[model samples]
Target chain A: MTDEPRAWQVVLEAIERDLLDGRLRPGDHLPGERALSADLGVGRSSVREALRVLEVLGLIRTSTGSGPNSGAIIVALPGGGMSALMRLQVAATGFAVEDVVKTRLVLESAVAADLAGASPRPSLAASVSLLDAMESELSAAEFLALDAEFHLTLADASGNQVITATMAGLRSSIESYARLGAASVPSWPDTAARLMREHRGIINAIESGDSASAGAAVHSHIAGYYAETNFPTHRLDDMPA
Target chain B: MTDEPRAWQVVLEAIERDLLDGRLRPGDHLPGERALSADLGVGRSSVREALRVLEVLGLIRTSTGSGPNSGAIIVALPGGGMSALMRLQVAATGFAVEDVVKTRLVLESAVAADLAGASPRPSLAASVSLLDAMESELSAAEFLALDAEFHLTLADASGNQVITATMAGLRSSIESYARLGAASVPSWPDTAARLMREHRGIINAIESGDSASAGAAVHSHIAGYYAETNFPTHRLDDMPA
Candidate 1:
């Protein structure tokens, strides 16, 4: 006779297969833990554990409310899951930070190249709006928020939603470090000015449908910042002051 | 005074910080559901809901035993996670299957280019071994398995684990369809022979440090598969019966 499989694995497989089969769309609500356990012939505890794994992937949202539908609602992929996993791998010595940086540069450059060839000029209205917001910002935090919006806009204009989402996740995962890096600059104004200049150049290239130039501009922009700081990639312990 | 934060968000942040800070690691066990709920100051059910999200991410594995170490364990990222996510997006109309194929071609071509560099020469041996394995495979399943290994080996030889892992994930995700497609060709031996020839060509390029040819060969190998099938490119729901 076959030894019964673990209850949690059964629960995990059920949900996973549903996801793979397209039965569970993002935003779909899952049954309550007790109900799921009962239906699957598993313990409630096992059901709970399976759900935890899915959350790490940013696939669903969980909440408590006094109703039948109050449980895990399938969430859109979060902006942090990919980078969180990447960061974990980096921390675990599976890869190097430099390698990650290089990967990012390559992927982002590819995105820029795509943007350049886009039939309609890349729409930077959102990016421009964020740039406008940044122009008036005085504090580091204020500027950093706008800075994120600008980069995300660039990713979006590339017209690759999957890549844009992944890039956004990567950028946001290291966002605190980025802000700290910006703050550490002796000449904050100068650093911001440099970023603004690069942003302007990128916007110009996108507007002119210059794919190669846009890709090169993004490469230089990233490389220049790292060079300025001597590429001060931080460890997980090095959170903002 | 600020109200208590959402339990699920609290659970999500706790897990994120734990993973990032090295408090929890892949393969490390988490406390039992009852204990975790008490420690985190939430009801047991809220804890379960949080767990659901994590499971979708391929992050944790859980089991039953009353002992302290017998509970949820953080696991290595599963190969299925990326594929499942991509499948959903493809199903959701976020990207076409042809877009996925083109993206794969772009990524693999880059990997082939990297393998052409001398510094990464030692890594190419794995791909060569996989090619040998494919030559001896007798069954479709065995052939598919070796084919998967060969592609993954190519990724590793390219010297970027991130890209390798990503490509391996995407390839494995669509693998069943790929195997079916391969089975459909009336001239199976001819198709296998063609693949062997392309593999040899790629191996020769890597051996000779010819980056351009290696990249071009891989591109042609993938694109040629579609052309041989008389399908211009990948399309949704287009898998062979």
Candidate 2:
């Protein structure tokens, strides 16, 4: 296997398979590089290369030194790292901005509905306060930052780490385009006011335990803003009208 | 910057910032290692490490040989690589399986609804054929391959690459657990028959252009399968009942 094409990939897959089988897990220290290479019958260089990929993917952390923590240890999925990768992918690949907005509508609406349906409904106090903060005088940049925080809070309220992480990952890409779109709004104050109203409506629906309304409010809030900016509203039409 | 902690990270962020600002894009070739090192004031090794990270993230592909394509060229996001990383992450981190299911319900339901609303409705003929093929006798692994293809087709039909990529990435992890859960079903034949029926129902709803019913059917089909399998169904309760 070491002599085969992409020898490092073989080592990566071996580790990945072990992970999938639950043989390795978070906090489990990987064997030392020399030992791993010997066990897998691959060169130490191959083992090191494979570990580099895993580390970049947030699967493991390596510490330097002769201490107990020197070797690689499996780690929790690094949400921030995943988000950074996603933001970069979205930026470099030029995935259609409209498609991202549509995707957000689907995910955010579901998140809002999920939060609304939770038995002991998650508190929207943090989210609502963001809305309140928005009502005061602020620059578009400041308002957009809070706006993102509000949506991220809603995603967190869904209690699904995957959803939360994904939303956080896409936020920067979404915000970049949103900031561009914000520049086109006829009136910043009016646009901000409308956004605030929509935010309040979404919060109220979630607080009142109205799942359908909560979903609808989220969908409308996102779609309305894009439509107002005249930024290719065609995709929004496919969503609930 | 070279003396800073994680200097390679500085190189990575510099390129990422350029990508985000639209200074870099798909199909563009990155500067050679020497030039990047000089421009970023980092060592060539740091530049190489940063490039390797970007390559693993599917943001670029490097070709060897002193030809036109020898350098790292920005590439479209590689869905398969992302999927592999996600599967490994889910396995190593023990991200709650139930959280994955709930996230699926949110995503798949939205995809079904979106397909139903497409103006020149995306064809479900391929999807319908997969359902037809599943009716014949097959092993669990065979059935699962078809099942994944079916969901992926629906995701593709929604016309959002991001959602499609995300669904594709989650499919393997979901399939691993779903296969395990399948073992506990009271009657395999009964469960398979019910799944087939639900697939047809979802297809019919989409074909008839009833977005709401299509979404509802997909939601129920997934939630129902988990419920019947006696797999931890606690998370389903948080979704809209």
* TM-score of chain B in each prediction: 0.84, 0.82
Q: Give the RMSD in angstroms, all C-alphas superposed, for model 1.
A: 4.4
Say which docking band candidate 1 falls in.
acceptable
lDDT of 1 by residue, A8-86 (tens): 7798779866655666767788888889999999888788777765655566677777664568977756444565555
Q: Using Cα atoms with residue i matched to residue i, what is each candidate's TM-score against the true structure?
A: 0.80, 0.84
Can you list the residue pairs that collide in candidate 2?
none
The regions of model 1 sitting more than 4 angstroms off are A1-3, A19-35, A61-84, A87-95, A120-122, A232-241, B1-3, B6-12, B18-39, B42-96, B118-122, B184-186, B226-241
Q: Which parts of model 2 are misplaced by more than 4 Å?
A: A1-7, A14-24, A27-52, A60-73, A230-241, B1-5, B17-24, B28-45, B63-71, B232-241
For residue A36, give model 2's deviation from the true position in Å. Answer: 5.1
**Model 1: DockQ against the native?**
0.29
DockQ of 2: 0.39
User: Per-residue lDDT tens digits of candidate 1, residues B1-241?
Assistant: 8987767768766876776676776778877778889988988777766765555445666566666556777775534455555554444334445655656777777677767866747556677778887887467667768877887788776566667766765675466567767777788778888888998998888778888898889999988886675542333333333
